[model samples]
Target chain A: MTTQANTDGIVYQLRDLSVNLRRRGQDRQILQSLNFEVRKRECLSIVGPSGTGKTTLLRALAGLIPVEGEITFQGQKLEGPAGDAVLVFQDYGNALLRWRTVKKNVALGIEGRIPREESRLRVDEALEIVGLQKYQDSYPWELSGGMQQRVQIARALAMKPQVLLFDEPFGSLDAMTREGLQDELLRVRSLHEATCVFITHDIDEAVYLGDRLMLLSGSPASLTYELDIPLTGTRSQISTKESAEFLRLRHQVYEQMRKAHGAAPTTE
Target chain B: MTTRTPISLTKSGIRGNRRHHDGKGVAPMIGLLPIAILLVIWQFLGNPHSVFFPLPSHWWTAIQGVEQQGNLWSSILATSLTFIESIIVAALIGTSLGIALGSIRWGGKALDPLLDFLRNLPAAALVPAAAIVLGTNTKMALVIVVLSSIWPILLNTRAEIQNLSPVLSSSIINLRLSGWHRLSVMIGSALPGILLGIRVAAPLALIVTLLAEFITNLSGVGALILSAQQNFNSAEVYALLVVAGLLALAVNSLVSAIEASVLRRHGPST
Candidate 1:
């Protein structure tokens, strides 16, 4: 079957995409019929309760896992990891190469593919983007949780990817650090001009960072809610979060998440 | 997050050597006090005529005499060469075998029984068998040492590979690192474990090397000790034993220093 031509702004087009995985010697369905379009250059925030197969969905989108039904990327069938896509993991400690310095880790994906000079330049640029130029020589283990996460992000950014798939990238950080990184991500995303699929369970984070939001919930998780974030212009953590529109969107997402998680939604 | 904690906080504090660095190198100096006291006591009180326990000055004289005879340096070199060669061979074989078996889902299981039996066989017990089979040559001694010392490296590497974080594996895939790059990353991640294995195997390798030499009557320090005993030269025998002890101490210190220097980049293991 042929997919639509790549003339449209859509980067990822999914149709009845289902994923059945082998878990503990049993074939379990993790994602069921997830149909959506990830728009070009848009931050698509996917929020869901814990254990709702949000990571599984992100894996399917990254083409890192097998999925039933159609999932097309830029009018082509998505198979193994795409050349222009990179992932930033939440467990930054494990995701980074502890043996390597921050600069070397950032250069990992792009090095040996490009010329040595270009690779070095790209690593320097990525570190600058993450505000980690000073820490380029330090190992990841020597950094704090927030800085380590930035290293992971810097590693991804150095690839100059078309799609940045983040799996709860700031979920482990403290609230203040998470907010700071969220702003930094917005700036980096704009500078790099890459589409992002950010997975998170935080309602406020989903609303604050997303250009658009999609929720995956229930046992065999599927897209249960979708909305365009109305708050526009430059986003600061304090002002944007305190704004009325941000509060409204955050509340709507929380209510939908409560229903999706099988918790009774209160009228109040 | 901007301020870094003291490096000692990251390392095990129970070790006197580590505390030595933070405590102005005083702990290790203090640690040598008991040995110094014992040596002083022995030097002052021990009889020079005792066959079993000769004076410290006599041991020095005996060792000097052996050195003058030209047997001391060559014997030490031979033993050191064998020990070094066996460790290198064992590390290569062990790491390769470990990565191969650990990568495959069923490889380790298939060889479980054989590995268990081989690893349990005493290194000393295998010395005579190896001497008979390989005719007591350097190659035979190498095989015996490697057979005993390889278990730690192989086992540690395998466990590390098996326990490699899934996030790192997925990151490797997502980054689309080429085959060579992937292997480099894999080896880099497993290096700490491999180094740990080498640290454990160093002492075992030394013991097996000495045993192989002693049992096979090969030309090394072990042979010198054996010959000194046979000739009823108690002073030379005691001197050679002290030399052997010094070798042990040196190997341990060297290996630990190397391990620490390398692991400094990799961070303290967990």
Candidate 2:
């Protein structure tokens, strides 16, 4: 076992997972015979270069993608788009049910058709977790990108799913807003302690948010390497991005992505 | 809960603030300018003594004469009742038929040619046929109005439903929203288009009513126009034309107002 999977409570085990995707006129095998296991309540970020199928692999986990793979959750054979593993797409605005109020949209993720009172309580609780209880009645279009993302998070959180999958959930936001949202997400994850798989092309975001980093190759992408981030103090957004270990991981992921892309890392 | 409420309020507040700042009031008034100008020009051009058609004042004189004779309101009442009856029945039939047509693609396709042919039939030509079937009575008037007005509403709604966004359907299906829940959320979302179809048909309703009245010789504005023209009361003819124009304007405005309210209620979420 890798030292990473050596931790407690294995939440998911993906066995020899392979995914092939076709876009436009070309068919490519993106995830080629990959094996990974996520432990209970651990936050893992999958980072890779653009066109490296980071999002595609995340979708595979969410069961949104049709792949040749076996994903088991709590030792149960998974079905397609497993409701237990909910996905939050990066386009928060589009992710939400625009017609529904924020409260109702959050309420949408609640499992099963339940009593009104129970759904209401769950909805309120989820909104509170995302710090968005105030905007419950407003529509998604009204909310800013960060707030919309919070609504998305709130909705996913409401589902009370075993796994939370984010496909670059903050990729569409501005730098400052994305940073704030990253911190907000981290705080929410810390509080809820849900198993998370976040995929992003951003090296810094992967370093900042992940417990373990996953790098991927370019075209017909495959997992390149994995690294663990060590932290010793209270991590805040601004400070952590500038932290030494964070920078090291960030640099390493950057170099790996460049190498996978067959290019030298540009001095930016 | 409390925190999210603040965000909602803040968002609406920001939107409200932006709208107030961006208020360029001239555009709306520009729309009204044409009507005001046209009314003025029309009123003058309709002068009987003048070279242009006949003064609107002359039209007013004829209107006053009809009011003097005191059959104006009664005849209008007679026509209005038939108009109302035809519209309610047509709305029900058209909306229901549209739903059925929208639900069945092949059926709609098969009927498309027939519906197109029917829609193209000139009201003037249909008058004699309807008159023969229903006789020269108010019922005949009703039939004419229904035939003329139903097609626009039925066709538009069917097209709207057929062209509904597929994204919404999949989303609802994914969520397992079936039966009543699915219809309410999914079909209800497309209400803007349905409401728009109704709004577009509103003008057709009035036009058909008038045309039907003219066809059946029923006592209405259409009959009034024919009578005036027959008696060579050009002033009365112009007056009847003006009243018809006003009625058409009122109906159109009412539909527009209704459409606006519906759009506001449905919002941009559709």
Cα RMSD, each candidate: 5.2, 8.1
Q: Which pairs of residues clash in candidate 1, taking residues 3 or more apart in a chain or in different chains?
A: none
Candidate 1: TM-score of chain A is 0.95
Query: Per-residue lDDT of A26-131 in model 2, one digit per residue for the tens?
Result: 8778888778888778788887766777877877776666788787766665566566777777766545666678998887755358888888998998889888
Candidate 2 has an lDDT of 0.71
Total backbone collisions for each predicted model: 0, 14
Instruction: Report the Cα lDDT for candidate 1.
Output: 0.84
Error of 2 at B61 (Å): 3.3
Top-scoring candidate (lDDT): 1
Q: Which stretches of candidate 1 lie over 4 Å from their true place?
A: A1-7, A264-268, B1-33, B43-49, B268-270
In model 1, what is the error at residue A188, expressed in angstroms?
1.5
Candidate 1 per-residue C-alpha lDDT over A193-227 given as tens digits, one digit per residue, 9 for 90 to 100:
99999998887888889999998887788889999
- Candidate 1, residues B1-270: lDDT per residue as tens digits? 110111222233213333233344355458768976887788899996898888777878999999999999999999999999999999999998887877888765677777778888999899888878889899999999999999888877776676678998888888887678998888888876777678778989988888888888898999899888888888898789888977987786777667667666776554
